[model samples]
Target: MDPRPPDETPGPGQQPKPPFDRERFIFKTLAVVIGTQLLIYSLAAGVCGQRALVGRPVGQICPGTLEQLQGGFDSTLKLLLALLGGAALTRMAPPS
Candidate 1:
């Protein structure tokens, strides 16, 4: 017969291990990054009168806001594409 209880938990000052592993962490990170970028782009597009569904026909944005939003969108897109391309290249590389 065992002396210890079957449902033992961590002792004081000890931390429990996370439920998710490395793959889950990576997936969550990617999801958050991509989701955030998409949200920002959508909001900016709506604000700048560029989104097809929610945007107004006449321009309602401030003079510099539209340009700034476009520039930010372009930069973010380039960065995301570069990161995805690099990851794909690494994945496709043969083991050395």
Candidate 2:
């Protein structure tokens, strides 16, 4: 009847490599990373723009001065800090 051998075979130190799903993991991780970066940049840009328009040059009185620009820059830096906070939140996602 059967002359070959048993179907179940086990090699030394080769405990059937616990099935790795690479493609799914890669796509999901990339999506989360890229999305986070984009969100951070968008948030920073929006905040800075709003701060820059706070005051100055009303009714063609005059262009914005250094103080106004400095205020905007300071707000931009704060926005960056907020962005960092947003990115940190992504660490809790899957496949850590």
Candidate 3:
């Protein structure tokens, strides 16, 4: 009889499975999503330029519309920061 727990015991010719790491999984997923978003945003900004995004001449003073667009971007950045901060905190917490 095997002395190991049933779940820990591997069948003949089978490798033991590693324990699932929730934290690593979450970090990797977030990295991929954030990386993709950055890539997309970089491409858009490069191709479209600030003038296209803001619908104004470059270096010209603008009001309302630029702020609205900038506010949206700022909100998105804040949300991403919050998500990353929460994930970091969760990782630092002691396991239950």
Best by TM-score: 3
Per-model C-alpha lDDT, please?
0.68, 0.58, 0.67
* Alpha-carbon shift of residue 95 in model 1 (angstroms): 0.3
Q: Give the residue spans of candidate 2 off by over 4 A.
A: 1-18, 56-96
Please, what are the lDDT tens digits per residue for candidate 3 over residues 1-96? 998767657789999888898767866776776676666556555544766677766453334445555566666667668877998899799999
Q: After superposition, how far is residue 21 of candidate 3 from its true place, in Å?
A: 1.0
Query: Ten-residue segment with the worst summed lDDT in candidate 3?
Result: 58-67
lDDT of 3 at 70: 58
| Clashing residue pairs in candidate 2 (N, C-alpha, C atoms within 3 angstroms) | none
Error of 1 at 29 (Å): 5.3
**Model 3 segments beyond 4 Å from truth?**
1-8, 11-14, 50-96
Over 7-94, each residue of candidate 1 has an lDDT whose tens digit, in order, gives 7588999898777665457656766876776787677656555544565454455446656756766776677678678878988999
Clashing pairs in 3: none
Query: In candidate 2, residue 90 scores what lDDT?
Result: 71
The top-ranked prediction according to lDDT is 1
> How far out, in Å, is residue 74 in model 3?
5.6
Name the Cα RMSD for model 2: 13.2
Comparison by lDDT, 1 against 2, better one: 1
